[model samples]
Target chain A: MAVTMHDVAQRAGVSIKTVSNVVNGYPYIRAETRERVEQAIAHLGYRVNVSARNLRTQRTGMFTLAVPELSLPYFAELADSVIQAADENGWTVLIEQTGASREREAEVLSGRRRHLTDGLIFSPLALGPDDLPLFDVDFPLVVLGERVFGAPADHVTMNNVAAARAATAHLVALGRRRIAVVGAHEGEQVGSAALRTAGYRQALEEAGIPFDPALVGEAGLWHRSTGAETMGRLLDSGVEIDAVFALNDAMALGALHALHARRIDVPGEVALIGFDDIDDVRYSVPTLSSVDPGREQIARTAVELLVERITARGEPAPFRRVVPDSRIVGRESTGDVPAGAEGRVVGIQPGGVEPVEVVGR
Target chain B: MAVTMHDVAQRAGVSIKTVSNVVNGYPYIRAETRERVEQAIAHLGYRVNVSARNLRTQRTGMFTLAVPELSLPYFAELADSVIQAADENGWTVLIEQTGASREREAEVLSGRRRHLTDGLIFSPLALGPDDLPLFDVDFPLVVLGERVFGAPADHVTMNNVAAARAATAHLVALGRRRIAVVGAHEGEQVGSAALRTAGYRQALEEAGIPFDPALVGEAGLWHRSTGAETMGRLLDSGVEIDAVFALNDAMALGALHALHARRIDVPGEVALIGFDDIDDVRYSVPTLSSVDPGREQIARTAVELLVERITARGEPAPFRRVVPDSRIVGRESTGDVPAGAEGRVVGIQPGGVEPVEVVGR
Candidate 1:
């Protein structure tokens, strides 16, 4: 049913190595011999088995990106950037959706790691410190974005704490004090929610303001519906708020929806900001101010790190964490009344939070 | 270095065939023999060569999805749905980005076809009539969306003409006389843009309205920027339009941006509508009205078709075209003043529009 390399070699009346050289685009092969092998391959309908070649070369020339879901625009955009970076390095990307399931995330390491790809660039939303023992498997891997901290691989993520502080500080700088925070996951430790919340508090304390427990809004997931739902709950809590800082852009957009439904003018009686500067924010009615977490940099750094580990397979394992710089991008959301402010960096992390250790791109 | 099957066979004190049978989950072998083979495999850290197995079985149990880019939410969601469908049938998906280039689309047919996957589910944007002949390849393929109209393979697409007509008629039914269109490709013959435009004309003709060329906005890509730029030009052209029907949701969102920038009210002085009910459309400020083109149905049909072709490789070469049913979903954009209309079917093609069908799932 399928032609093998041996069949092509037999048809060409040449050694299998000669036929392999022709198929591999080896310049050393004689023109006449190469032509004969090429003709034999064409006649026999021979397909070079990439995985079999990978077995021989010990390199698959492919990588897998395991993200939660593509329906989320942030992950989708992150995938786009990762694929672009992978393409630049001459690799095809295999997409694996986990849907943020703990079982599925663990299965990726145990089941799909072998004989599939050279390395994996994974972003987990489910598995956390409890799953670290599973990461002891002998595989070249790079982790990205939230969960599985202290994994034995290169970890590329945004400065969530620093970036959140900047976002909150920006709203405070605009003369808004009573800010509500949306999309806080319950009992989160090192996740994006917890870190961002810590930064938000730091910003409040720096401004000589006390942290109010009622200002924190709980969301089941970082979805638009949840954002709106949680914000609606916050509004119904009877807590007077003059500003809002949702963890991500989707929740912020959702918060905007809630505010509009309640007949509140954005950035007039209340200022607003979100994280993860997705492109849609640019076209939103009032536009949106957000923390640009350097997603492209995350993608490039993750892929580069994975490639490095793949090429240097036998090297001693080095635990690396690459944190990209971030800042608050001001837009119409944080503007004063009739304020269509130009996009400016409203806040930056003090001391340039690019972590002096580990490699920087 | 990865362990080989020969080592496992050696350790098991059995023939390689016996070990292979155990690894392949073939149940004919004795339970005792299977246990011995499994223990040997576990001890030796043996991994079965998937490509070598593919050579023997003539099936990789995998599929490739070649789209222009995943940055577009439509393709990303389509990929998600395709992966979901494939996973149900026990298959992994490989993603290949073509960057919407004619050369790259053709290359997939030639270069990436061999020894990669059991089948390919492609959504080509750049390839047209000139590349139709390349579709006659040995690999099993199912193409999605509006391109390569008469290729000798399975096609699963939305009825663009009918869907577009339905969208336009929705606007017309809202009592908007002068309707402008955004995202018309320049001189396209059988693409989505051309089919959609033709449908818009058909709807206008049905209403006894004249086809005004000035109302058709030209755009190179169906992106937000192009949608806004074309709508901006339409406004600057002084063509008095009471409504707009953009070809896609992204463009419609962009048109909203331009309208917001110009201080024109949506669904007030001018009504608006778009196609492809992407999730973001639901969250847009005015909540855009769009034609639900049955994206999940398209993905399911395409993957199912490719799987059918893979399983029944030597069956009669029946060229199937599965056109899923589409309906217009109404939101604030096309609603009467202060009207948030519920979803309704504005138009349905008589006889169900299955002119030439191969299989419908």
Candidate 2:
């Protein structure tokens, strides 16, 4: 059974308006009357009816966060940060898993469920530049990631190209010449895959290393299995690689498994690095080196921007694109481990990616 | 800007009632009128007012899924499955992260935000048997995991004790006698850690091996870091463990890392196993052996039970506690690799935990 304010009011021998006033913290209420109402409220276990209040105010006190998938550690951690940020802003989050489907991503932006929440934070994976017009919907929407660029909505994203270049450069700086890139998409340009691929080529070009197309392993889904499969393919193809850079941490971790399976010594024989510094990177064997894409910052900024748009009245503010700063977190995989630090797990330094001291087998 | 039913009605040159009928798919609507209304709906980009409809229906078509944390792979995967199951039922999911705090868990059950969702599927980690009264709330709920028992709600849980025993037995079957249990809570009389520890003791006793208190590694949080710390402690203590059974996969994976760091050969010097069978285990180097605790089935069953309770009217149905089947998935960590099989990822068999045919290093 739901406890109502009326029940509390009846118990307190006060009018519903009086009870409401007490609940809303009307400072003018007599201390004695407030005390009685409060006691009744406590006794009845009454809570303010947020839905009723929201209906009158035309705000749900809720928002939708649409991500590709939660099982993926990156999105999971992102969702965690977004929820935390939303909670701090006194809002609840309803998660919508689009599964990276174009149809579902379209439905999320279609204003089909606009009345359900005050606004939406969308991360589109399948819908790219061609679907940019779909972002023209009249709703409080904040876009995430390097997809559907220049959407007419507040955008919060990481510098995928810059971060990818930094990751590649990290590998190059390790004196590894034949660096293979895992999780490359075949043909055309756009989205994270293309942008990151461009960055990888940039690092290679800067290093004066000839871009070998054979070293580029193409994979779909960017899943760990695909990463492993791609790495296995690269290894089996007899591509002499001294280092490997995967687009994201998932693929990198998979590649790590593949390397380990082959008994290849990390950082000794082949330096490795990844992007999107998910928590898994820290726990992986030998500890993975990855690009800290400022996930929490991105989430906080997205929530803040979405809330700003949701509560604003009349003239809408000009949409702005936000790109959070990202850095490379070097661990054992990238020869960043300090000697004599075996069996020790290094902790992250706030606001910076420090070279982790240890880990292995 | 939300497109209203009135906008569609105006554009279609029809009454709002006619538009409503068309939207609701009333069979009596004329084909020509329906076509005109559909065109108007598509043109105006109108969507049904779910909030308005919910207000009248007194149901939000949403449910809350409260887990400890999403950053953990187990919870992330569970949340994914739960979201999928909820989606299949046409219900939106609102996720609440309790952070495993007793106060937050209590607040979730207090019905303070009851109107936000139709029901709750809570997987509590903090609140135990002493908090039984908290679960007596009137809302539709489905309790998850080995937390408080006999709560006045439908429950969907995995058999923690049995699953843990099975995992330990698998290690014993591999001729491991000096088995160390990682992630045990000291003096824990209830909950997962306790149940799993009991299962470990049972397996050891059954195997005619004496239980060693020194082999019980206590960890507060069943995190990967904690698992690593515990395993490191156990190894440093010179406990002479021939096997390790981490309570869950996160800790097991962590323990795996610790063993790797120490150059301890898994399934050679030490056999290893874990519970919950999170996706990480499959991707981990050497591919960990773990208990497949029917996580997907648990999610599906919990959603099914909660929805039944939510939609039921009048007299309440008898509370049911459904503990799904669980089995051991053996991988390289337990010497489950088949002959001459390497450089391949093993796929899971439906409804069964198959011995993985390959993995490495």
Candidate 3:
């Protein structure tokens, strides 16, 4: 049987409140009393019942993270990083999938089940700035994603616009003109699709290259299938493109498949680049080049922000944006040369090529 | 502002306890009083706070599922199914990754964080039968995995021994004798590795084939890299094998990579099979053949068991084993058909394959 606080108090000849005070690090406790309680705790092996303590404090010491889907490797990796960060801070995380639906996203922020958790870290895909009022709850929330423009909460995200520009610039640096963009959502003014498209255009304009409408492929979702289908459509439409920029790794993989089916050699006939440096990219057939969007930093920042809000005891922290930098990871997919460039490999770009367009607001 | 129970009770001219009773559907409330409370609830738009009500009942309406990792697609998909099942029962799920550490597994069952959750659905890879006593705590728990034997709590898992036999038998049926087993844990006696290895031997004996020790490859971890490395080691050891069975999908993928490197024609020169029907298998080059261990059913059953325990109000429900069936999903990798037979998909095994070996001593 586990030892109770009462047992520890009895063993130390101190009041149960004194033990509690010591355990909670109450400043009023004398050093000798604290030392005695601590010694007794170690001797009796009295581990505090976090649940019982939570009842008194009305805090569960647990947080909830709601993402669109985990089947997507990106989110799966993100969740893994978040859990690791949360564990380091002595908190447990509950995971929920909103499936990128507005209703589900709203439900998560409603706080109807707030008692089950101390706070929430939400990544909404469908909910936008128009739904900002839904976040007006009494719980601490740290939002991730570009779907919601100005939600009232702490947000940790990548510089989507700048990152997209960097990816396009990398392809341009490889001397590939007429770069095609895959995974753009039609009629959308914000979100990842719009932001990445804006960045792509920004890079092309700076390079003095014409922005060709025929080079833009519309993808409803940034999924592999969508990317493949869009790439096929772009080709079928007779777009003259020597390079491709997929919004994410999944789409990039899909593009690779499409190009393979058409016997279009990557970086030979056309260069390819993707976003989100997913783990699989390293092991891909040609090892895809992608953008590393500081995922580790985002996870740590989100957890720390949520923790600050929880510890502040109702002092609402100002909504702050954590903009992490993104770097291009050059691999064979981008025609980057093999490490031992002894002329054995043909048509390979030199390693560490500079960006064609500089990053700026 | 959200409406509170107080508003409903005051409007209904009844005490808060009466409103609580009505909301909870407690027996013995007068019919007219219930009717009045219901009307007041609807009029005031008072949605019951699930978390607060759980607090009053000393239950959290939340269960925690601890797995080794989420970066693995199998666990991520399993978590998604579990969350879906829990949501259907008006419950929430919390996720924790123990990294297959015995110490962390012990902490989960320690009951120190009981207030954060009602029960736990744990999948332990490191701990075994010797640690069962550690699970004898106040809170409820359901164990998931083939690692532990004779656990006191309810067990939910795939029939690893039987499934492995069926997988090997499939290879035997294909006229392959000298089959290699990848991803075996050397010297394991009772975990999934040991059980699967025993099944492999049983299948070999039944086929009147000698069990070649050199044919078994040991992997430190059941990952794709390890699988690939083990396959390479097996080949380097000069083991002439006609077929290979990987313990899991990741290892199988690694094995595929190894075979490709060696220029072995799959199904023509050597047939390859893997366990765990990961989503990526369908799109993989040559596509992978694998076993579907009814993970969806296991997730649903675990969630159902936890929900029952939570609603039982301290009543101890009898523990039972949920042994879901497994079947082979044949793809191009198995060499079941000629190349370009993409559309000729086979159906799931009828009556589902039963476990070949039952441990009922």
lDDT of 1 by residue, A267-293 (tens): 788888999998778777778899999
lDDT of the structure predicted as candidate 2: 0.80
lDDT tens digits by residue: candidate 2, A182-274: 988888577888989998998889889899999999988878889889998999999899999998889998898888888888879988888
TM-score of each: 0.80, 0.77, 0.74
Q: Tens digits of per-residue lDDT for model 3 on B112-138? A: 455567889999888876775555444
DockQ of each: 0.27, 0.26, 0.18
Identify the CAPRI category of the predicted complex in candidate 1: acceptable
lDDT (C-alpha) at residue B207 in model 1: 87
Docking class of 3: incorrect
Best model per DockQ? 1
Let me know the DockQ for model 3: 0.18
- Inter-residue clash pairs, candidate 1: none
| Candidate 1 residue-wise lDDT, B54-95, digit = tens | 553756677889898777778878888898888888877777
Write one digit per residue (lDDT tens) for candidate 3, span A43-67.
9888865544455376677888899
- Angstrom error of the Cα, residue A91, model 1: value is 2.7
Ranked by TM-score from best down, the candidates are: 1, 2, 3
